[model samples]
Target: AQSVAQPEDQVNVAEGNPLTVKCTYSVSGNPYLFWYVQYPNRGLQFLLKYITGDNLVKGSYGFEAEFNKSQTSFHLKKPSALVSDSALYFCAVSRNSGGGADGLTFGKGTHLIIQP
Candidate 1:
C-alpha cells in the first residue's frame, strides 16, 4: 500500500522568511510524489511533482522539493514566504509499480500560515 504523512498540522512563518512543510511517504516500490495547494474555498491546484529525474524538483510559485529516497521524504520548501502562499497543502503518493489507475493516497494536509 502507498501512503503519505504530513506530521505538522500547521506551519507558521513570517512573510519574507523561508518556509518548509514536511512530508514523508511509503510505497511498495518507486513512488510518484506530488504536492497540491487548496485555497480558502477553491479546489486543489497542482503545485509540483517528482515522477523521475533530479532529486531536487522545482514547481510553481518559486517552490521546490527535495526527494530523499533514503529517508522516503519529499519536503516542500520556499526561499521566501508570502501572505498569498498561505493555504492548505497536501502531499500525495502513488506507487510506480503499477496498480489499477486509481487515485493517489494523500496526507491529511498542512495549513501554512504566513504572517505579515
Candidate 2:
C-alpha cells in the first residue's frame, strides 16, 4: 500500500512570486505521483504527474513538479503565481502495477493562498 503526505496545511505566497506546495510519498515499488488543484465549488483538476522518464514533469497552467526519488518528494512549483492561482491542492500517488495503475492514495488538501 502507498500513502502521500503534505506537511503543510496551508502555504502563503505573494502574487508574482514563485510558489511551492510540498508533497512526499511512501510506496513498496515505483510510484505514480500526481498533483491536482481545486477551486472554490469545483472538482479537482489535474495539474501534473510523474510516471517515468523525466524528473521534471510539466502540466496545465504554469505548474511543474520535480520528482526527487532520493528524497521521495514531488513538490509542485510555479515560477510566478497569480491571484487566480489560489486554490486547494492535493498530492496523490498510486502504485504502477505493470497492467495499470492502482487507485490513488491522496494526501490531506493543502490550501495555497496567493496574496495579492
> Relative to the true structure, how large is the alpha-carbon lDDT of every model?
0.94, 0.92
Backbone collision tally, model 1: 0
TM-score per prediction, in order, is 0.95, 0.94
Q: Which portions of model 1 miss their true places by more than 4 Å?
A: 95-100
Model 2 spans > 4 angstroms off: 95-101
Tens digit of per-residue lDDT, candidate 2, span 81-107: 999999999999986555663678899
Candidate whose TM-score is highest? 1
Model number with the top lDDT: 1
lDDT of 2: 0.92
Error of 1 at 53 (Å): 1.3
